[model samples]
Target: MSDDRPLDPVQLDAYFALIEVSSLLRHTVEQQLKESGGLSYVQFQLLATLGDAPSGRRRMTDLADGVVYSRSGLTYQVGLLEQAGLVTRAPSQEDERSVVVTITDAGRAVLATVFPGHIAVLRELLLDPLSDDDVEALASVLDRVRAHMRSIPPRSAAPRRRAPTR
Candidate 1:
């Protein structure tokens, strides 16, 4: 049988603090991205990731997994980017069912324009407060947590089953 108990105070505090900090960070970054380049944070992330790819392209599913956005949400954002001429999407050369997204010259230009301000805001809001050791530990801890979370199905998708009998 599993333990169905509630979290202890320490766990509760940590959980709340993590939630609050994530909310604040996301809000601030979104505002910064919007003001700087008129792009949502997710859009900027998608563009940046594509820009860094060797061919300025990646499979749609790869992009979806690289960011926090859902696959459907990424499709919508990619549509907006395509309309703006910032990116192009086509059937993957290797797999017809997969899509490949490529950052265009315009996309690279936007990233170039936004990079400075983005770095400044990130340093100010997220990095400046952390010492070197703190930053390393923070990355390590969050990376582990993210991997663990990704291993589980989201709550909405989790299977529902009847309780077991002895």
Candidate 2:
């Protein structure tokens, strides 16, 4: 009367604990963003990329890569931020059809106010006791997770297709 269900206890417990920890830490970071930055976790990620880019800007495609979003999805997010005046979009000089997104002064202000608390929350929640070796090992495992899951690109973004001119 055995069922086909496979609940290997040891494996299940380890996986469940890892996921619980991940979610707990994510929630802590998100809470900090709301309290200090008034932004969501996704918004903070977008703002952080824009903050680090040259001229505080990057192509929509590039932003999508940084945020692990589809190009269209990131465009929509950027549109929302643009409407809020936290981001601005312009035609890329190097590629007329591609859009460049820049963080606005207001955006930077929010980041400046929120990012410190965000990092603090992250450290307190996840990193306080982690050794340098642990961090490197975690990074290795995360990279493997991404590779194994195919959740992110296995390769760079597909090259943009040029429009055919008449």
Candidate 3:
């Protein structure tokens, strides 16, 4: 069913601006993560999420939900982190079918090393352009949007990863 309500010109402008800015921000962060720690942006996101968790661990599905990645893609990134000795994965005690991933001390060290630069980049690229009021409004608006998005059933965050290039 389609709604017959008219679209506002202001909403169209905001929608396009949001899309363009988000794309640019993601690209910039991907480049920064690659240069800083030889990490893909999604890898850094996984590490950061695990690092910030109270238990320093999360189930595979939970990690998949928390980050912009698919379950299989998250599994792949977890494997990379495991191979790098930055994290560990084991069968969950509560649910044998679910895997639990935990950030290691090495993961924390990597975050400590990289977080400062991450903040600097965020400030320079996003925050510096906004006034205090603008920042507050942006945060409030985005938080509302995020809540709306989360209320919907989730789909794959993006296309599944392709085979690596030689």
Candidate 4:
């Protein structure tokens, strides 16, 4: 009998490569955003997310998730924006425990000014080197990977059972 245990080699390689590339790409984009827009990447991300939200506002937790930041980090960033008069936070009508973050007119104006430059720099860093066909192929592959990931069941954080009484 052959003793070959089951393992997903392709998934393992893809997962590792994704982790490495995500970190590197994020850092590179962060540097570009800082230099070109004079805005930290987190601030730019928050403004963009807020602009995309319905009513130009989102629960603070939603904004935090969009930017991959902790709740306190989002609070601090929003506090800075509030000080700059670029954004406002108010109580959420839908949920008392949640705060709604909305971008102010000044924030929208700044985002508009920075948008074009951001697109140009993104192309320069990531897409300029790839041909249309290559980009399409990469996009297709990524879509497949994302779909596969979505197919997997979410991890269950089931509570542990206490030892049975003797």
User: Taking the tens digit of each residue's C-alpha lDDT, what string does model 3 give over 1-166?
Assistant: 5898977999889889889998998888888778878888888999999999999999998889888577778889899999999999999999999999999999999888778888888998899999999999999999998999887747675446789999
Prediction-by-prediction clash tally: 0, 0, 0, 0
Clashing pairs in 3: none
Model 2 agreement with the true structure over 1-166: per-residue lDDT tens digits: 5688887999799899899998998898888888996777777889999999878999887787777776766777788888889999999999998899899999999999997888788788788879989999998998998776665453445556789999
Worst 10 residues of 3 by lDDT: 151-160
Indicate whether candidate 2 or candidate 3 has the larger TM-score. 3
lDDT by residue (1-166, candidate 4, tens digit) is: 5758765899789878878977877787777667765678899999999888778898887776557677777799899988888899999998999899899999888888788878876687668989999999989999998777556622322234689999
Best by TM-score: 3
State TM-scores per candidate: 0.87, 0.77, 0.88, 0.70
lDDT string for model 1 (1-166, tens) is 5899999999999999999988988888888788878899889999999999999999998888778667778899999999999999999889999999999999999998888888887798789999999999999999999899888756433556879998
In candidate 1, position 82 carries an lDDT of: 98
TM-score of 2: 0.77
Q: Which stretches of candidate 3 lie over 4 Å from their true place?
A: 4-6, 156-166
Select the stronger candidate by TM-score from 3 and 4. 3
TM-score-best of 1 and 2? 1
Decide which is better by TM-score, 1 or 4.
Answer: 1
lDDT for each of the candidates? 0.89, 0.84, 0.89, 0.80
Which residue pairs in model 1 clash with each other?
Answer: none
Candidate 4 global TM-score = 0.70
The local distance difference test score of model 2 is: 0.84
